[model samples]
Target: MSFERLNQINDYRQLGNTNLYVSPFCLGTMSFGTDWGWGADRAESYRMFSLYVERGGNFIDTANHYTNGTSETFLGEFIGNLRDRLIVGTHYSVFTQRGDANSSEDRLRKMVQSLETSLRRLRTDYIDIYWIHHWVFGTPIEDVMRVLDQVVRSGKILYVGVSNTPAWKIAQGNAIAQLRGWSPFIGVQVEYNLINRMAERDIIPMANDLQMGFVATSPLAGGILTGKYNQLALARQISVSEMLARIDCTTARASLNQEIGRLNLHNLAISLELMEIARQIDRSPAQVALNWLLQQSDITSTILGARTSQQLEENLGSVEFQLDMTQIADVDAINPTDSGMLYGDTVYSEVQDILLESARVVDLNH
Candidate 1:
């Protein structure tokens, strides 16, 4: 479909089974401040925020530890009067105060303290969605679920989500919540992109079976799928020897070189194929990559981050067009998910045939 025929940013979707409606693209505020020396400044951050809100984007994501709390502070100012109209989501379990024993735990005390601090920094009364940034080993799953449920009951949070967690843990925690009459996780956030199909092995399937929303982060694979690094390597004509020599000099350059080196032949092939598809469609590689994630089933929304207004604008254009089935299939063919040991094509087909006993299996969506 043409850009002109694409859906507007305001075409919202229900977050899981909740009553809340949010934009297809979530505005990630990780780069809201330059405390990390690589983020956008306050002025540029506000500009990006204004532009996104003006374009009908209503979902904003932040974390307590992001930019050392500057992200939440900046968002507090940008969202002054519009808080009632937007869905604000923030995470905890990663940030902590010095000398506070319970600060880093997922227990009741830490969750409460963290939410209070986040609320103060965000200049809001209640959070729309609260997430446990990551699983804390040794912490009881029941404790986490119960505290989250308590917060939801107290109106401190409207919904709960989990990020950077395993699929089996998510399933176990949610099942416990259901049995105990506590709040279940309505959404999941994970690293998903063209280069990383790990989530497809379990997370995506789990979310589908549980009827939960899947929020994808790093859909650009840390900018690898953008094809910029490939262009740089080609333009500079840097040989392997020269690349190795430079890696021993500057730390930043060495890091970049390492990241580029980590991109195996499969990754490079996907990047090249994505660029070719973008060229044929007259769109940026980043846009094509984001659109590809958005087109997947069970993907409720993808979080987008930018260091400048220009980058944000380019990313917002991802929803301007839809990839045809052929284009999508071609992309999928290059990065097919790895079927597990018991679920290979032959084994799965035989199992299905024996189970169905000559009955035709129909795909509902088709």
Candidate 2:
């Protein structure tokens, strides 16, 4: 539980059911370039990357259109010698070319073009994990699976993943792919944190059942878990409902069929609890929040994003300690995730007891 331990390497584990062994934490490169204004510049990006690499982290996450392509470009420059050993993943399907019909409309062709562009940007021949970014309403899953299978066969990408996608779609798509003997999604990426446990309702359970690598993104819930918003909440006197209604939802969250919510009174209360827990444990609020995600048996990896070496240094400390069951229970009690209808402990067992009491069938999951 010291800085010395943080420098040591944690054993690499397999990602999903694949042979691809990855770090417990994935270094998110969304902040690798300053083109987004809030991101890091070349020097600071290098510092953060080196800090993560030195900490024995290798799994990296990026997107094709991040910072208008500067993120991949910066990572390309940074991974020069370690490219072969590193797990470089990138996302596509942002479609930011605006009115360019061919590039923006067709998902299949666009994925192909995006893969080529990302390969060049990352200065690599093949991406370790190629994500579809998100699911759109019109894009047929059948076509997607087939095309991605073809892409994998071509050796352009090692494996496929989905982000910001619904659990049912993932199940259906994978079932179809398995039946057709095509490559399916081996992992899923979703925003999960102390405040937003929506992923737990369906996505996490589905991932656990399917053996898909579940990578939790936005582990801090848009910096809310860092307790920065606690002071802002103190300054702004508003009701939880009013605060949520007044605030704007980010486009990404809205597009993913997520609740149009953010740092409201309820969320701020969670932030306060996080800070209080950190104070009692003598750990950073970020570490407290990050460790909770790490403890989830289902989460294969949590994305750590930082704009500076100092931030990355602090995030790396997340693995140095563990959250006791009491602390975890306290957090859960204060901010409980809803186990909605038919999910979690809500369904199945009761019905099965009555229907199959005479000769109950063995649980497939067992």
How well is each residue in 1-366 modelled by candidate 2, as lDDT tens digits? 011122233557678999898887899988878775567899999998888888788899999888889999999999999998889899985643443433432267788888999999999989999987756534567988999999999999999998876788889999999999999899999878887777877888888788899898888877777876565445688554554455444533322223434646667778888889899999988988887777766777889877688988888888888777787676666577776543313322443233233442344555
Candidate closest to the true structure, highest TM-score: 1
Give the candidate number with the greatest lDDT: 1
Give the whole-model CA lDDT for all candidates, comma-separated.
Answer: 0.79, 0.76
Native-referenced Cα lDDT, model 1: 0.79
Predicted candidate 1 versus true structure: per-residue lDDT over 173-192, tens digit per residue: 99999999999999999878
**Clashes per model (N, Cα, C within 3 A):** 0, 0
